[model samples]
Target chain A: MATKLARRRSKAAAFGVFNPNHVVGGRVAGLIVAFWTAIALLLWIASPWKTLPTPPEVIHALHDLWWNDGLGPELFTTLKLIFHATLITTVLALGLAYLTVVPAMRPLVQAASKLRFLGITGLVFPLTLLTGGGYALKVALLTFGMASFFVTSMAETVLEIPRSEFDHMRVLGASELLIVWEVVVRGTLDRALEVLRQNVAIGWSMITMVEGISRAEGGIGALILNENKHFRLEDVYALLLVILLVGLGIDALVGLLRAVLCPHARLGKVRR
Target chain B: MIPGASVGEVVLDVKEVGLTLEEHLILDGVTFQVKDRIREGITTGQVVALLGPSGVGKTRLLRIIAGLDAPDSGTVRGLQGEELPAGTVGVVFQDYPLLRHRTVESNLLLAGSIGGLSAARSEARTQELLKTFGMEDRAGFYPGQLSGGQKQRVAIAQQLVVPRRFLLLDEPFSGLDPAALEDVSKLICEVANLDEFNTVMIVTHDIRAAMAVSDTLYMLGRASKNGKHVPGAKIVGEYDLVDRGLAWQKGIMERPDFVALEHELRGLFRTL
Candidate 1:
């Protein structure tokens, strides 16, 4: 008991911000959340909508999109791409991270991966040069171009794990497999998930861009491009609204997973 | 001729060990042997405080012994019977670094799992450690939800996920206050005594804490990585506090000896 008290006192002394007497009211948390919502509402209100459709019109448009026939199928197509593309990215990332962190393979793999990163720079502009067009090519390019991004981000997260954590496990007599599964995989999951979160916006955008270039049957990018090419400005904005809603939905899903998989993560909980 | 050369038994031995960080000589010519088990028969225990001036390589020596670093040269030998490599031993550091993402139960599971603890036995050990640490209530909470003392307790408990013949700790009680330090020290004693009768070597400059719990003690001197004594870096003195008078033991913290020792250690750094 004395020890517990002393620990509390010492920690209290170290961080001066915490007021022992401060009671966090449930209402204050709600109010702070409302303040953010009010700001978003104002942004939506002020987004040059007078020259186009207002926020209410956009909401009504969304209602029609949801309630109208065939739109649900269009939404599902984009969701499917997000799901498959994320899975591919994660798998490639995990494999690359394994190669990067596994000690026996670390040096050779790191050296090779570094070279791979250099090689990967070719993806940005070179793809526009080679295999210039076609739906198949666009999908292939998106997958290939983004594949290295997945590997780099995941491997980097795995590499950044503290060495001390590994040493502690090594001394405990943990085997390489157990260390990988329990220590490395478990420890790095949240970080890799964060990498996933960071790339979500970019990943979707890239996939949509490729989809449009390839003349893919579904996805917001294709839909927006087709409408804009036809000079259907109202449809273009309407498609833009659809894309924003879907992006928000995807963001919300990842956020929920983040809360479940790594609740203690102090950062990335709030998104812009 | 070495007076202690004929010491009958040695379970863990460090011979002519040294380490350096940047240009700073962290540990110099540190030598000690822990003969925790003689002929597989556990012997009476001794708690030795590794004390020195603050800049000495006290903690570095402990880390080298823990296999956290490769000593510039020399050797560390742990139990010959165990499967550990020629120079491997279990280690615990100053910061507990318990996994904040996992439950107390899962944390122990990770420790046991990564330590290559038998899957069944390790899981069982997790349950047992939970009971032993009186952390059954905390078994479900993440590290973020735990208090500092509890986190350290869990960290210490995590160390016991698997037991070996020797344990190396690097100033495990530094940031903790007197009472918490005592509790942790007592807990360390109990855990070490219960496990394979693991010989424990703790590195600390805390004179009072050194007296609090230890079977024997060594004072480190700061020397180059090659273990040569520098003009300013020397242990200067050593002591065996176990047999000291009760008055000295009880009053050591408030006494001149500890204060003078503390000042002497600080003097080594300031003069250097």
Candidate 2:
């Protein structure tokens, strides 16, 4: 039994380490992750830069921000802003994407998709002038910044749908309007959610830049910028960690919602 | 014709349908007609097979028949001799495209509703189809959760939820094991028997399986002029399996005559 077990272990190690397409077992994968994480920690600890905050300092800074500073409220403010912007962007992007089925709408959809290449900095002046430069401006800027990306992804999804799908609906005697609703609206809803998830991350990254324009709003972005201005490196690090955790939480939540609402999305994917 | 089956009015008439793509002629004057088969005061559905080599424009012709695409010349007329409208004929693509986000039951219900059934009626039909397709337990499952055969079944059931007279299947026998092949063949027959006017046109290269299930066989190939090959695909051969006493028979594939015909068709298919 001992010899058999040893042989199996050797064989697994041989395949797992060098085979091009061989997938490692769960335990081995977990070990690899732990090994890499430990190496990164060691490298960080042994860094030559004296200005870099130690792990303990970063942790203490996080605690201080949670208790002394208004991190919780600032996070809530950012979350609320993201929620509103995401809702508006979703409706606009989906509408524009679905309209591509119309011959006239194709050019407009193409124009909207191309808008992503335009820098948001160039549009901020016009956006501020239009919105009177306040909280509304920040929301407008975020929405403008994210809308093109969302539309691009969704339009591609809409286009990638095979011609057979529409034919399938038509054969069922579906009216033109019904085909749009069934194939475009409902058929791609799950993919829309996925696109939303990706765009939300992009929006989150841009929140700080947008909030910097409206410091009175007091979002996490503003807080991070203010800390950076003071040269409080540890606090900045803590704030960044907070942002990472919050973003991950939001991503996971949206993914979970997709699984619940569109459970079919995860089917046929390789599960660990 | 089969002993008790009588051919009736032409249900589908294709006249000189032709298509060209990017300076290349794909289909040249493809013409055929499908007539209703009546037996014992019931309209038993007809199964027609379209055989062709790869890239012989078989799928393009099928798309034209399904009204998903228009031919550059000629017309396809339905039962009333009117131009076939998009969605008038059902199509099952080779990949069995289903709305990935929807459950099997929802997919069927959507098709039924689009076909003009009321919500309650659609629900009732969905249930009946799920039961009939032996997918009652899997009605809650999504397309991605199904095996290839199961997905094919759901795809077929999706079309049947609506009262479609003509159905087009593209490569239904492609990529199936022996057992799965037999199962799909049986399912195709069952689909045909469900309604008298329900006609199935299968676009495939699998001669044996096509011959096993289809009552009529049409071969698409480039015609030869003066011993030289022509550029476009056209219907080169037509066989009435019913008149030949080979269609709708149990264990027919094992018979000597069937084997001989299969061998002969195999030789002909290689030339195309």
Candidate 2: residue A153 lDDT (0-100): 93
**Candidate 2 lDDT for residue B31:** 91
Candidate 2: CAPRI quality band: medium
Q: Tens digits of per-residue lDDT for model 2 on A112-156?
A: 999999979999999989999878998888898889999999999
- For the predicted complex of model 2, DockQ is 0.66
Give me the overall lDDT of model 2: 0.88
Best by DockQ: 2
List of chain B TM-scores, one per candidate? 0.76, 0.96
Where does candidate 1 stray beyond 4 Å?
A1-50, A55-69, A102-135, A264-272, B1-8, B19-28, B35-44, B78-88, B110-124, B195-197, B223-237, B243-272
Return the lDDT, model 2, position A151: 94
Work out the TM-score per prediction.
0.76, 0.90
User: In CAPRI terms, where does candidate 1 land?
Assistant: acceptable
